[model samples]
Target: MTYSLLNLAFLVPAAVLALVATLRVPHRRRFLRGLGLTLLVVLVLTAIFDNVMIGIGLVAYEREHLSGVFIGIAPIEDFSYAVFAAVVLPSLWSLLRPSRRRPRAHA
Candidate 1:
């Protein structure tokens, strides 16, 4: 499969997990704001580092696998991994965290 298709294969599930976590987790507003900020930071860093790596020939992507969209020399597909990480890591963390509740008082 093409790179974009492969990226979507992982990204779709990660996005779904993130959405479910956003709905089920407490403090929806806070989680969303944090997710947004995390995405922004990751995207920016990925773009800068990816472009530098590509320019230096340390990183290379097959042109046929790319969508022809780019931010600098990095294919847009390159950013999806960061996006997936930003969404999936927090979702998995929230999902796996132990619930906190006090035991009921004895009669």
Candidate 2:
């Protein structure tokens, strides 16, 4: 299989878990859209900065095995960092917010 496709093995599962974790919190839809859009912006900014740094040889990918898709000189793995950031930030944000409603009385 191609290197790009090989990455799906990790990215897809991590994304699925992220989605599931995000959805498990109540009021998810109310916040998820805004959170996702915010993450998109952060992702783009970080990707550009990271790729440029890699291109300039400031830091390097230690892993020899990498998906060869390059944004300039950075590997696709760089973008995956954004995905994790998107998932994790939102999950933590939800965890921090206090619940708005108390549980209903048990019958």
lDDT of 2 by residue, 1-107 (tens): 54455656766876676677577777677667867887889778877899779878898865556766777777776776677667666766676768778889999
TM-score per prediction, in order, is 0.95, 0.65
The alpha-carbon lDDT assigned to residue 80 of candidate 1 equals 90
Cα lDDT tens digits, model 1, 33-54, are 9999999999999999999999
In model 1, the runs with Cα more than 4 Å from the true position are: none
C-alpha positional error of residue 4 in candidate 1 after TM-score superposition, expressed in Å: 0.5
* Cα shift from native, residue 26, model 1 (Å): 1.3
RMSD of each: 0.9, 4.3
Q: For candidate 1, what is the TM-score?
A: 0.95
